[model samples]
Target chain A: MNLKELYQEIILEHGKNPRNLRKTEDFNKDAKGNNPLCGDNVHVYLKLNGQKIVEDISFEGSGCAISMASASIMTDLIKGKNEHEAKEIVEDFLGMIKENPELMSENLDEDEKTKLMSLSGVKQYPMRVKCATLSWHTLISAFDENKEEVKTEN
Target chain B: MNINQIKKEFPIFDEKIQNNDLVYLDSANSSQKPKVVVDRINEFYTKQFSNVGRSVHYLAVAATNLYENTRTSVQKYINAKDKNEIVFTKGATEALNLVANTLGQSYLQEGDEVLITELEHHSNYVPWHFLRKSKNIKINFAEINEEGEITLEEIEKKITPKTRLISITHLSNVTGAILPVKEITQLAHSKGIIVVVDGCQGAPHLKLDMQELDCDFYAISCHKMYGPTGLGVLYGKKKWLEELPPYQGGGGMINEVKKDRISYGELPNKYEAGTMATAQVIAFDQSIKFLESIGIENVMKHEADLVEYGQELLQKNNSVKLIGNPKNKGGVLSFVIEGVHPHDIATILDEDGVAIRAGHHCCQILHDKLNIPASARASVGIYNTKEDLDQLNESINNCKKIFNL
Candidate 1:
């Protein structure tokens, strides 16, 4: 109920001075994603060194605090992970937000659970879940293009 | 006039949201249904549910009578010349598109012009845009004055010898400014240009007579006028309807189909293709009756009173900026607080059980012209009361406090 707690200093700082906010111009794979409902758009670029993501960078164009912060944190999390590990991270993030099945098991580590719990506020607002995950899904599609794999249902 | 008595007719007023009474103020987008309309649909399914005008069975005959009676009701509702001029469409969007596609294609030449205003909704804008692209016709726009009212001078300036048609909104959904349709139609007619009026907002608030207004075509949506969704009325003059070709080709709209050619049906049926929205059409009759029983003059007076009350209340705060200043406006009032974004203001209002619309309102071009990202709109209807306006004023004041503006 407290908006001060909802929009904490960490979220504001990440939103204001986002990390990895640059275009990968020479990157092999890139894709543009947009949430048509809210008009949030993000262009994700992936520099993959033979399936291991060497440099994962993104630049976002959005209107809200939560969406920009989510994009910042997602780009920071998957900067150096390989494609397989990045896919698992996306699945974990999707589970935390959309209540997907993988994270329902009670086997998460303390730090991983804490990191996922940062997005727990999104569960209360269904309309905002897409805003929080737009950048992450775009990154998934970028990696899919790099690996020459067709995307499944979003 | 009694809030409690009127509240009893709408079931949503009794429903609780977040353990609080629901205050719906999005009637400009779509009005909530009264019990009469809801029960009309219920009765049709329970007793007389059947497709109309086809079967010889008893239910079909009864359904045909009910459906044809609705046509008569609508003909009288808008004071059209004949029932044949009324064609049931999906909604005003489709109705406007029906006119634009058929008439715009048949009459408009490569160098001709279609004159519209900047205040048109996308439904009125995009169809003409498509026509311009396909037919190589030029689209001209009349400018709005500082008061958000379109002037006769502007319309005259925009019209030329090549201008073939003039389509405009009867009332602006954003600023609630009522355009002078009768004068504009007369001017357009004198210039030998046909006129089409988007009556989605006006039909719900004002009294309309197609003959008196003398507009060649008028598009109306049922949902905005307390009827069901998926049904709208397009009132065109019989001469124009007879001249224009069929909009869509399908089963009911045609009389016969041969190897290469086909014969079309009668006046209204020629334009209405496929199986119509029967149940919603029947329920639309009840919505018409509901409005008729209250009388449109009373509805207009009550809404005008709310508009004046809202203007007096909200404009007291220095932070609130009212959008338009027409001498004759509708019940809609769009405004923006000084520092807070419209979306944030809407969010805070929603937490306090106050509903409003906050966006470009499908008028992106108008927003671009006004150079504002968006504005918050509070529109009124017959079901609304002074208490609703008070809630809106209080909630907007709370938004100012929250933003420390």
Candidate 2:
């Protein structure tokens, strides 16, 4: 309900200069996601090493401040985690965005949790919930190696 | 005309939205209904509700009279030659689909071309696309000029020898460029091609005269004309409507329901199959009365002033780029701000209760041609005023500040 809370300083900064906003050099898995409502789109690239660790995570897309900031912080926090731990973080973030009060993932540190929680303001704006979760859903599709494109209609 | 007094007739402005005053400017999507129209819908449902054109009972006859009255009013308002030429549909989408579906069934042959424009909404284009798949009809698009207008020259150039029909939008929903429908129709008729117009945006703003324009079919969205939803009117020439096959086959649209052979009913009913939106059709009569009270010329002038004022304000603002600098424009004001997405702009504006639509505005083809993902649009109606545009510009400044632009 509050615009100030929705467009926080950190979100504005991260949205302006999104981190890891590039395609992975040797991406093994990639998936495209589109928010057909606003025409926002994202393509997530994943580079998993031999030990099932996410050696690199990057994304390329154009969207609103909330969506760009969500993807930037997601890539920054999920870069070093293994595939299993990364999937857990994605579930935790998705649940928190929907109804959960806070993220409940042991894999994420306090700082990482706080960074992701800034996007929770979108929960109040139900029409915008898809913007915050499009990239995360695309990341999951990339992990599963799903060939179909991810489409968010919420 | 006193725009403020006209705004008071709409009851939604009396209430606050999210604790902020409602500055509705999304009329291109759907307009706010006046109190008279809403009250008529309630009165019809509460007291005189009955299925029309079915029974000879008291309420049935009265309800049927009311529904037919709307057809008469619409026929007179649009200057159609006959009352039977006006057929109601679910929406303009369905109306246009009816034209395409029937024409594809009876008229268009394989490899025949139907020319459309880049400024068309999906409703206008997608129907012809069906003909492409089913009947192998070719669809050609007339490109827009730099001002975002589908000029008569473009239409003339796009027409080939095999072009059987040319369907286009009366006004671009995203660019607000009002096409020269009359001239285009004349040019197409000269070449023996039929013309269909998607007037969803135009019906609410421009002066409509079916005889003057002389197009084959014109589709109108009643909700955008300050009427109820689930209602649209397709104004077709009597010759075409009689020649084309029935779109839907069901109750009321039939003459004799036999096992082997079934004959369709008369002109209007032939297109309207099954139980129609009777309540909406009745309430739409009041909508035409509301517009008549104000006069279309006055309404046109007032909205023209608002668009001019809003355009000048947005043009002066830094970092704001207005789309489509067409000399002849309608009530739409589509623009984009650099370093900010349209969804972000719309959200920030909604905080101030400045209602505007953000997205491709259902014109993705136009967006792709313009080379942008999406743009924000603030369209005006009879109820909006200069003060609302002022509030909109102020909200844009606030959004810019929030983004530290």
Candidate 3:
């Protein structure tokens, strides 16, 4: 309900020019996700090295400002982390968005947590929480190598 | 009665929607119910509850008479020749499916073509698609013009000698372009092609006269007419209803059942197989009376004015692009902002209790043709006022300011 909190200046900037919004050239893991109700879709691509460190991560999709910003911030934070750390960060972010007061991931710095917490406004609008979380769930699907596309519910 | 006074009839306006007075602009999705219609449902269930079309008890026969009385009311409302021509279904979706399934069973043959417009809702398109997969039937789509209208010319261009049926919406839900159903039905009948209308949008606002239109079949959504949910009316010609097979087989639709052979019942009971939505059907008579009280012509005029005012308001706003410019439009006003996504706009608007719809509106074919993922829509009803459109315009400005447009 709070428009200023939901459409923060950083979120709008990220939505306007989302980071790494392209197909990874040598992606090893990938998965698709969609919000069938709103026609928003995303494809997460990851390039993992031999030691399972995140080498490169990118995505391709079209959606509203909240979704695009969520995906952009996610891809920015997820790069260079190992598989275990990446999954933990995903869980912490999802937990914070759902009910927890703050990000609990040991891997994320204070600045990174603040950037993700900017999306906490979505908690008030239950219908829009899915828009912010769809791309994060799709990233997990990519890491797990799940073949089925990820679909979000309210 | 004054059209503006109609808002007082619906009690929802008196309550605050999230601390904001309800400025309902989503009536095209489903209209707000009048008190009479709502009270009728409660009265029926409270004191006069009984299963209709069965049993010899007093309440049963009384309920049966009440149910049949609604059928007669609908027949007179739509100007149909016979009362049995109007059959009750679960919804407009089921009505369209019944037509497609029954035609697929007896009338349609393999390799035959069914013509539909790009403006059809999923309910109209998906039923015919089932026939395509199972019977090798061909489904053809008539393209819309730049104004987002499926003109008579466009429909004519798509018709073929093998086209057995033409199913289309009486009004485009997204574009609000009212199709020339009567003229199109005339053309289709001349070529021996059946015409089935998806009147979900049309039934609420338009003047429905099945006899004058002469279409093979028409489907109506009662919820959109300020009636209760779980009820719809299908107006098929008596001849077609007699010829087509039953859609769902159950207790009521059978005349005689045996181990080896079973015979179907008469026209309406043949289609209404199981226990129907009796209370909703009975309450729907109040909805018809509601419309009759205001008169369709007055409703049409009021809505037309509202749309015109809404169109003008949005057109003057910068960065707001109205979707269609059809000369013959109804209550729908679909648009997109250059920078703001429709979902974002809708969220911002909802904060002010200005209810509108955002997405494909179940006409993905039209949206795909328009080459956009989705657009926002604001549709008017009898209770909507010019001030509602003004509030909508002010909200759009707020959304643009938030998006830094």
TM-score of each: 0.87, 0.99, 0.99
For model 2, name the residue pairs that clash. Answer: none
Q: How do the residues B234-345 of candidate 1 rate in per-residue lDDT, one tens digit apiece? A: 9999999999999999878888899998999998889888889999999999989988988899889999998999999988878899998888899898997766656556
Every model: iRMSD: 3.5, 0.8, 0.8
In candidate 1, what are the lDDT values of residues A13-90, reduced to their tens digit? 666576677887778877777754334567778788875755656664544556677778777777777777777877
Q: Which ranges in model 2 have alpha carbons more than 4 Å from their true place?
A: none
Clashes per prediction?
0, 0, 0
Number of residue pairs clashing in candidate 3, backbone atoms closer than 3 angstroms, sequence gap of 3 or more or interchain: 0
lDDT by residue for model 3 over A1-154, one digit each (tens)?
A: 6888888999999999999999999999999999999988999999999999999999999899999999999999999999999999999999988999889899999999999998999998898999999999999999999999999987
Candidate with more favorable, higher DockQ: 2 or 3: 2
> lDDT (0-100) at residue B304 of candidate 2?
94
The window of 10 residues in a row where model 2 chain B has the poorest summed lDDT is B359-368
Residues B239-327 of candidate 3 have per-residue lDDT tens digits of 99999999999989999999999999998899998899999999999999999999999999999999999999999999999998889
Q: For each candidate, what's the DockQ?
A: 0.18, 0.88, 0.82
Cα error, residue B249 of model 2, in Å, equals: 1.1
lDDT of each: 0.82, 0.95, 0.94
Candidate 1, residue A64: lDDT: 52
Which of the two candidates, 1 or 2, achieves a greater TM-score against the reference? 2
lDDT of 1 at B131: 80
